[model samples]
Target: MSTLTIIWIALPFFVGFISYLLPRFDRIFSLGVAIASTGYALWLYTQPPLKLQLLDNFGVTLLLDPLSGFFILTNGLVTAAVILYCWNSGKTAFFYMQTIILNGSVNAAFACTDFISLYVALEVISIAAFLLIAYPRTDRAIWVSLRYLFTSNVAMLFYLVGAVLVYKASHSFAFAGLRESPPEALALIFLGLLVKGGIFVSGLWLPLTHSESETPVSAMLSGAVVKAGVLPLVRCALLVPEVDPLIRGLGVGTALLGVGYAVFEKDTKRMLAFHTVSQLGFILAAPEVGGFYALTHGLVKSALFLIAGVLPSRNLKELQHQPIHTPIWIALVIASFSISGFPLLSGFGAKVLTMKSLLPWQVIGMNTAALGTAISFAKLIFLPHQKQEKQGKIQPGFWAAIALLIGGLFLANIAYYEAYSFENIIKPLATIALGWLAYFLIFRQTTVKLPRLLEQFDHLIGVMSLMLILLFWMVLA
Candidate 1:
């Protein structure tokens, strides 16, 4: 088991290095590595939980329990899909290298049982993501990547300090050890993870970062990387259940704010980015079932971003005149409806799980977010029919991703069948209907401009600092 764990962590980086050295076969090599890594993770999922002490005196440990196993499996599958999509997309060798490194870093983050290891893994992932975001190196892309770097660094500073505090308080960095630490330390750590988790206010950098990058990069960012933050947040929730109320409150707020901004978004990618924030709100509110939601969102949201990438234009208004391929069109529609919580899709199951423990008002807020999501995506159904243009066949990787995502949607239903009742399924359908009505009544033919507060990096940093101080005070008091 230990030997397998070591191989799983090292395989991506090793393959990435080989790809960098042999640029001619980077795509094929990376694709093969991804398939192997994903297959290994599936095998690992079927085994009993395993723990290995890498450095006994230093307290470094690797643990693979059910939760971590689930994330590792998701990471493997998403990375494979991403590699497949990028195969024919004209990415350079360095792009493959960074993707591979990021894949390993994410796996490491999920598998680590200690705080220091997790923090280091997260930083590695962040650095790789920053480089990937800046790969296009356009003026806008560079600026957005820089902002992401700065914000992520600040969040990590919090994490580092909090880790020190936690170690000082508990004399150990393990999750089990931190269970009894002071609330102040836990709050600090949680705040740091929240920034990465796409929580509202703290995660102001997410929308631009996710929307501005290349489509494949955006898909990975939205689909996989953001969840890195949430994984630790889940750990925090387990250790410190007292924070559940605050998490739920912030979750609902983030959901409403995300969808509110998304409804007015003109760019297709940016709209999906905002919905990422909103969907994250549901996960935060229901930490108990958050993993299930994250898995579903990661798959469907990645497909949505990939579909956007394949489109002729990024603007929703221009889609009508664009000659979209039929399979791509079907995939886009399925993803759009899935995200909007249409019945019988993965999103429906995730939404049901998210709302299972919510209070009445919280449920109302989530429903409203769903309605906004529907309204925003309703624009896609109006795709203008144009004569089919002669185009090359879509790659097998693209088809594979779409099929996996659609399959994931149905599989979620089967996996959580006990959670699905007539009422639960009916609610999402009703929500979609209300969303369409709300779209016509409120959002149709109206343009709403978001305030520039979130766009200002300095202002966001200041707000984040203030929130951290307030949280500390609340805990200490």
Candidate 2:
């Protein structure tokens, strides 16, 4: 089992190097590799949890528990979807090579049992992501990708310092003695995680980055890569459950901050990007269900971003005029409903569990965010729908990606679902109805103007610096 696990972890990197050797068939080979990896991930989910020791002297090890296994399965599915979406992208061999390396890095990061291993794996992911985002090498792409890498590296700096402090206090790198670690170190670690996880103010880089990158790259960023921060964040939260209240408070603020932009934003991908921040808040609000919620969000969101890939324009003013392919429209409707907590779906089941754990104020905050999601997604779902021309055939790979997510959605609903009551049925319906009403009203009346500072790189770095100081002060106090 350990050998198979190692193979599963290394499979993508190996196949990717082979793609480099045979550049001409890189696309075909990448697709084949992605499909195989997805199957392997599912197999891994069925096996009992295990740990593998790699460097006993350095205390480096890999651990796989239910949480790690959940992310492993998620990374595989999201990666396959990305490759399938990019199958006809006409990218160079280097592009596919970087992608598979990124794939392996995410797998490694999720499997790491120690802070240093996890941090190193995450940095590798950052490097690959920077390469992918800057694939065009245009001035804007380069700048955007540079900032993305810059922010990620800065966040990791906080994590590294925290880890060193933790080691000093606990004399080990593993999670075993985390309770003995100082609140100061844990505070710094989670602060970094919050930024990487795309929560509110610290994650302000998300909108510009996710919106500006190429469609497949955007899907990868939102769908899988940004998730690198979440596993560690949730892991830390679990080991020190005393911080649950603080995490939940941030969750509420993140949800509000995310939806505030999304509700009024005009750019389609940018709006969805903010929604990503908001959805992470939903998971943070219920960290115990982090694995399930993350899986559902990853699948549903990648599909949405892929659909965004095919659109004529990400701007709603232009997009509403163009007819959506019937298939794309179907995907939009289902995904939007799934995200907004409609009945008999993954979002509804996740929300049901989430609400059970929330205080009254938190529940109210979540409902407000749900309304914003509905309002924002209305931009896509209500667009004119029509059939495709005979010559314009949607690729089976595209449908395959959507099919996998839809299936995952149903499966999540089944697994998490308890029972449905009248309020469960009516509440989501009311939210959607009210959201659409508010959308139309707001659409005619005014536009939500985001502060220009949010887009400035200097502003983002300044905000992050401010956050770091505030975090230290709070922890020390």
Itemize residue pairs with steric clashes in candidate 2: none
Residue-wise C-alpha lDDT for candidate 1, range 219-309, written one tens digit per residue = 8888888888877777666657666666777788888888888999878899899989988887877777787788788888888888787
TM-score of predicted structure 1: 0.93
- Give lDDT tens digits, candidate 2, residues 1-477: 888778877787888889899998887777676666667666766777787887565667887777776677777788777777666756789988888888888888888878888888888999999999999999999999999999878888988888898899888888654578887787778767777778768989998999899877887788777778877767766767666676787788888899888878888898889989998888788778777777878888888887787777788888778887787788888988898888878878777777777777788898888888888887777888888775254554677777877788888788765647878778888988998898787753466677768668788777877777766666555
Worst 10 residues of 2 by lDDT: 388-397
* Model 2 TM: 0.93
Each model's TM-score, in the order given?
Answer: 0.93, 0.93
Q: What are the runs in model 1 whose C-alpha is more than 4 Å off? A: 320-325, 359-361, 392-397, 473-477
